[model samples]
Target: MGTFGCCWKIFGVALAAIFLFFHDLCASEKAPNYTFMQNATAAPPISYYDYIIVGGGTAGCPLAATLSQNASVLLLERGGSPYGNPNITNLSSFGAAISDLSPTSPSQRFISQDGVINARGRVLGGGTCLNAGFYTRAASDYVRNVGWDGKLVNESYEWAEKLVAFEPPMREWQTAVRDGLLEAGVLPNNGFTYDHLYGTKVGGTIFDKQGQRHTAADLLEYANPSGLTLFLHASVHKVLFRIKGKPRPVAHGVTFRDATGAKHKAYLKNGPKNEIIISAGALGSPQLLMLSGVGPADHLKAHNISLVLDQPLVGQGMSDNPMNAVFIPSPVPVEVSLIQVVGITHFGSYIESASGENFAGGSPTTRDYGMFSPKVGQLSNVPPKQRTPEAITKAVEDMKALDDAAFRGGFILEKIMGPISRGHLELQTRNPKDNPSVTFNYFKEAEDLQRCVQGIETIEKIIESKSFSKFRYDFMSLPMLLNMTASAPVNLLPRHSNVSMSLEQYCKDTVMTIWHYHGGCQVGMVVDRDYKVLGVDALRVIDGSTFNNSPGTNPQATVMMLGRYMGVKILGERLTSDVVSN
Candidate 1:
């Protein structure tokens, strides 16, 4: 039908070989460092904890570890442990977890209302376990805008960096992409650093020299062993609250269910400071707030969940950085790599690349099922088993053709930095495990569409650059390729087909996700500057959910840094209170 229309399910290449340039800092195999379980079954049915953190993901694990330095902490994760999972551990089998689509898998698949297929972390390390392991801090402007203590922020970052962040060993494909970015006038090769800067730069990664991933869960090793208690597969039902005779409902505890569906209650120790913190991520935090009867009144009434507070901003301002890409096939085999280099444009956009991804990493035991998915935006609605008869036959033929060049290609992707366009998240069901319906409203704003046009044009320059010519496949001028051209300019947009496609239309049709979505329960709306939930006591949401504009190329590093930053701040507050009492 369309050009490479059936190429969506074709697989990526294996790492024909890995370059060993990094010194091995890995010590044996990193497992869960804290006390943990599949469920809280070993504990009493009703237990009291000074702090109950509902998630063990990118932010939750570090937050729990940091808070437990002095205060007793209980961390609840809806997913199982990330340990011993090869799909998540190996860099080669990168896309495996997201492709599995199984209930028990660490990466949970959810198609947004925008028809964009995406995955959420369902494991202890959270998005860090699911993401490409790119690690970079937010720009200085981002920190100032968030109103965080600059010094403490730096300190917190160092603490986490010492444990998890790593300088990736850049190989062939990534090095080419990096050079091409510079040649395209991205300028100022900032070299290896985690700071976000306006130039082509190499950022950090969680995957070490051994190609073994060290996730945020590894940060738990710093946790005080006796003070922290971690429970895996502990799905939080709703936050427990006390509303009687109070100015605002104060969160007291949380009700959760074991994997066996056995309900348990964990309460907070009586204090203004002791509280239930929800670190369930962007989609999850807002969904959780609504489930706890703490969202817009009208929406809550529809589901028959009584409103706790008419804090209408619970799920507003949801933003996802819209990503677009160009996959260039090479005549030569490409080395395997995740995100190692980045180009931060002054116009608030970021460019990055990866190669030789093994598609749907499949099960650790089932390696044969791995196939690299060509992220054709039009195929977002198409599942492998549900393709049209014509499409299915076409896909099979395309797959056979792709089988030859799978290892000889790579993707250079670009995403807008702070998308002004916004969306919202709402509950489709009351079940905690169920993903709430969300619409990112990508390219809703004309400015956002313009940014995509700029980003894509920049991508064209990279493909045309001398550094990338040897590696790039002539997939046609992007506009002519997407058939987003009306009258070809004879030079750039040659008269290919009389398809009435504008660049903006190409942007809209082929939009994909880099998975850097943030907002919902954003600061000043749902949470105070200190990340405490506004108009509510003893309840705070600490995760990417609090970001109005997502920071940096990848948001995981900033998110992990946030966990440590807030932990130190909270601990200081607790110590001050104890000192005053003494």
Candidate 2:
């Protein structure tokens, strides 16, 4: 065989060997059979519901819980039942379970016409049950910065915390890394124990004192109201709406399809009295709306989808947190336990409650000031105007500098967060049966480069700190940065290759992301400040997609809060109308 053929053969052999080694690991545990057997007894169908929530994710659960209190609620989930699914409810190793990325129960792998997309939860509790239980609230200032109703936002957040039982999982968590965290000055103080978290390092919340995962499944498991009907395995194909002479169109209902090629319609029962809430998460919600003719008119036309009520803003703004992580091998590889991985390390809070040159002349809200807001603030220093090819090149150079040291360490860290990115999802096919095309144009944004470089530098500083010294962590530079006379693109070397490079070269190949994807439907671009679709009536999107700016923190809390706030607003509107009519 030729040299290329030889390499391919070896590569194939290696892949096959690796696959066999983890064959069992690759396969997820089989989920329960919720299949309706023909010729067998069929469960009673939900003939009608006052409210029909499209998803069962973090936002969906709370929406169902709150709205179903007095009104009849029907929750249609495309995934399997999470009630007793071991893969979902009992999973302790959040990282491992999600890594499976397979469809279980009624929820099959969500695919577009071309047939591939990121993982999504198709179970009863949706993504909330499957996602990592990292409950960090959006930085309060971000809520205000977006011009959203702040005090009311906080109130909504507080309500969400109660409904979902938000609790820090620090009490029983006991990890040695946590001690290392303390030494490294990364812990935030628990207000219950100290006056403030500012300066005092602390761990993020992972679990509660009760040792529960605090999953949405766990939160909404109790006291399910009889009015809410949960229909598992019902995949929404399109949002059904009616257009009138009024400036805004009326949202009538949704048309959905089941796994067995079955089609059904869940109409709005309360008439103008009821509304359609799309909380189908960042990806699905926008796709469903667009398929039903609710996004940019031109794009929908290209897909041959008939226009019902051209909302134009339906799927324009989208944003998410970029994630990056590394599996640091403990020097001694001690016997690992739950406490070891899921401990809390608190960092002191920023006392920015004061105005003007505060906190040692550092902008309290800025990271330079030591206060990292989860929801708002520009993390990247790259000038917005420089978000072009030339700027992207510069950013890549900067990233190389930050990641150079990481290569020296034994473990290879992958940048899950892509800096300098603006990506969007498009309808691959007119058929709602086919999923939408999702392109996470990571590293496509010019500013992403600078932000990633800063992230790398920050992480490196933490590793070099006195506290982290106890772990004997060292930098691992990639070999490509080594002096080369050729003027070519700085290619990334194979992560598995046994090689070493100079710090300069290592910096050239470094990349990272937070795995937080936000912004396909641009915030403020499509939705108004009130989280309402600009051109559509009775249609509100309450999910991560509503985020105008990516909250640097985990988005679960923000999304949940949005659901709560939106629920209250929609309900309040109804209540006011009733009072006026009376």
Predictions in order: lDDT: 0.74, 0.46
Cα lDDT of model 2 by residue, 104-210, tens digit: 43233342221112345556555555443444555556666776677777786666555444334332112233443345444443332201122322323334454
Per-model TM-score, in order, reads 0.88, 0.68
Off by over 4 Å in 1: 1-33, 36-38, 92-95, 357-367, 373-403, 473-500
The worst-scoring run of ten residues by lDDT in candidate 1 lies at 16-25
Clashing pairs in 1: 11-371, 11-372, 12-372, 96-360, 96-361, 484-501
Deviation in angstroms for 454 in model 1?
A: 0.9
lDDT of 2: 0.46
Task: Give model 2's TM-score versus the native structure.
Answer: 0.68
Model 2 misplaced stretches (Cα beyond 4 Å): 1-46, 91-118, 148-152, 163-206, 209-211, 221-224, 244-248, 311-313, 334-420, 431-434, 473-513
